[model samples]
Target: MGRRDIDESDFHSRPTKRGSRPRTKQRPEHSDAVTGLVTGVDRGRYTLLVKDPDDGGGDGASGEKIVTAMKARELTRTRVVVGDRVDVVGDVSGGEGSLARIVRIQERTSTLRRTADDTDPYERIVVANADQLVIVTALAQPEPRTGMIDRCVVAAYDAGMSVLLCLTKADLASPDELRALYEPLGVEVVVTQRAPSDDETDGANSAGQTAGGMILVPESVEEVRERLRGLVSVLVGHSGVGKSTLINALVPAAKRATGVVNDVTGRGRHTSTSAVALALPVAVTEGSPTDTFDGWVIDTPGVRSFGLAHVEVSHLLRAFDDLDEVAQECPRGCTHLADAPDCALDDWIEASPEDERPARAARLTSFRRLLASRTGSDA
Candidate 1:
């Protein structure tokens, strides 16, 4: 009478396993895949610098060729951004009208990301495998926002990259205030003011010659160059911060369009629409025959807000090695916010001598401010 009672597993679990399906699907080896570095990304196209097979590289000379490529159909969901190292197949020749297919993306060493706003859950990858983050802020004209700078610094630290604070338009204002704020955090600060161009200073019977005007090079430009010499740096800032101007000055051949600040609104016009990586011009010595591509500069479009909703407290803390060590004494599962009970950071700051208190307090304040930002708070 119990014949009707049965289970689905009874029929599937049989003595003979021949009827079962294969456990795994075979994937292609792609042994002949060619490697290329992504230099730029358009709507659906990618500009890659393919390494020459025959060349033994010392800084990527003529052996590397720039090629245009598109993602292979199988990689429909993958996002290929600038600074990505990818494996390409088919038509890798960097010839006229030649296009290739990117089949696989190599593991990234680092990825910088930001959200549209504090509440946005979606994160956009700013750049991949960048070694440094250059936060460009204008000292005057459009004015600088310390909040924006803090966000950029946190993003850099979260991505495991070094930070550089580049204050532009020093002619209009002094970098003293900003420098004092960031220097204690161990962020390198470089201040620059546009040097007077020759045309502006030439007094050869000029009808109207301004003594000081815009110049191609600034006083601190050389220092900035030296800092960026061997690192892959990405520049980020809000609109009208002179990011484009700084880029143009750094790479003369870049020819990136510059915009003017609106008189009433105090905002700089957006110049760069997309992020593009440009090779830094190599330095030449008298007896040297080879040219060395020193580094790459990735110029990104200006953003009004840099959201950090996707970031976690652990990731942010990792950026501050000193704080991370002090945090080990904190209670288990400590939030480390300003009001967290028995938070060790508070005691750590108090234990410091009187002179060191101010600087230590500033760092703790900055860290907490960033932590507050993660939860959509302005604290």
Candidate 2:
């Protein structure tokens, strides 16, 4: 038969009536996967906290086990960041040297992002699932930069997180100026100062003292703690704004290093190199035997600038709910900029009663400033 002529079909096996075995294209259910909160990320490894099976003991006491994990091959393109709730598989015992795999990242309630600069198109996720953004600023030393604060506020509004202006170094300068600036935007402000201490005057000898003899337990500390009690807050600020110091105060066990501002340059050295989600100490009343975990505080590296290259003008406008309503009456395709012809925001502000105009104008100005930041244009 070969010598005569071999047709292509002659050399092949006869096809079955049912044809080749059908491939189901089914995926693994990952039924055994456990959920964990990502507390830290370094290199390619993730540090997660998984609740212990017996966490809620009879006394309602809860505990967590820390596990180290790496992203699964299937999630290579997914970015797992601090504060992300992820599904993990493999050995989740959190035993020494035991490794796990992150198979999935739970949907984030909010994501804070910023570009490297105004011109950079790539947006970097600052943190995930944060409910509040605490913009830490110093009243003196490095000096508060309204520009930076404004940019961070815009980022917070864009991410749908509440904004808190945390003013540090109040003893160095009054927070009235910065407070006045952000007050119109309805951002809550908290002013904190390192309580004066005799040991602080001892200078270098006080190195062993915590945070340079800055009293961690004080009224201002308690106030800040109260605000953080039930929210997942992310602290962001420029270098040397006393952010790490404040974190250490709220979470005594955090031990985040503190740095001093350079007398000449007025900039503090960056002590925190990465973002870490630290668990706040359980608040205990003097007579109460039970304690409660306040919430998580995510500490991020200081940023010199917060760019909004990835943010759109419409997103900024939408963040101002009141202004968004007025903007609805704007002419078709109105940019909403100050120069936009027949923009409704201007008419809205002009029509407001004198008592309400100041606030209305301030919000409009802030919204326009954020829009300008995106394009490097004047507000």
Candidate 3:
């Protein structure tokens, strides 16, 4: 075969002018940028609520308007989530077809995060700056999964956010069992039952409310509304739970879709595909005005699994105030599990007063269950 000639010019590296220009460390300040709350994130676009200075103008603007924005090129690696307080630049007028640029993401007070599974290292931030984590669990129909609830509570504790257990479908099953289990952990429990139809006889239950007289609204919907007022809360649960139904009751304008539990699998079908933050009404009463309040409720898609791969044992212990103090005296490198050698939790439980020993022991058992879950032993 004849020898082929190779192009030496192709082998020689050519200097491109792309990086020849000196790059400055300093970037634009964007002082005119206005702060906005990220209401929803879809694809690469973010929906933000920004204050409109000309809100009361004859243009018929409200105090705030919804603006769609994209992340700045400099923030290519940053993840912007719902409930994030961000500074945006560009056409923030929020007018039709107006798009803005999110230049900066402010520091988050709290970040709710999860992994795909217990062994997954990569973490996904569910929401940012949310002060409360509302875990919705059904008492019947689909059946309540304590494992899921425990994991959620641990995540909230790790994130330094308060946890609220919202039990739904009370009419189908009693919440007394679940209430006794979580209330001792200092977690607030709210039992919400569907109102009875007009054909049902009017009778007062344990909570002192006429089921027939009550409208379609859940009896404790007002309690949940008050807890969510003046704060940012994120609702998470399995598919069949009534997270969307509760959100609709809290904010009539939300209109989030609700789904039913699979008859065979006993799991809920996914209705919401992503996280969305909705503003609460100033007064959520039946005939109140249409104005919005300062509070926010972020409804996330149903999660089948909540991974704690990024959570450390130390952080998990901190979530249990009662156990954390006793855990401090344990031997170094203790797992705080039941089989741990010379674990202080076991000793502390035994040392408690006779009247309090049962309660303390129960807390210890609950804490150990959560600790075991992190090791992928049970889920």
For each candidate in the order shown, give its overall lDDT on alpha carbons. Answer: 0.81, 0.82, 0.82
Better of 1 and 2 by TM-score: 2
User: Which pairs of residues collide in candidate 3?
Assistant: 240-268
Tens-digit lDDT track of model 3 for 327-352: 88998988788888999989998788
**Which ten-residue region of model 1 has the weakest summed lDDT?**
202-211
Worst 10 residues of 2 by lDDT: 201-210
lDDT of 1 at 12: 58
Q: List the residue pairs that clash in candidate 2.
A: none
Give the per-residue lDDT of model 1 (tens digit) for 1-379: 5667688756855545787676666657788989999989999999998987767663545778888999987789989999999999889888899999999999999999998887788899999999999999999888898888888888888899999999987888999999877886779999777655556442111211112346534336666777888889999988888787667656655667777789999987888899999876554223434256789899999888898877888998887889999999999999999889999999999999999999999888878877776755657
> For residues 59-102, what per-residue lDDT tens digits would candidate 2 score against the true structure?
11257788999999878988899999999999999999999999
TM-score of each: 0.85, 0.87, 0.87
**Which consecutive 10 residues in model 3 have the weakest lDDT in total?**
203-212
TM-score of 3: 0.87
Count of clashes, each model: 1, 0, 1
| Evaluation by lDDT, superior candidate among 1 and 2 | 2
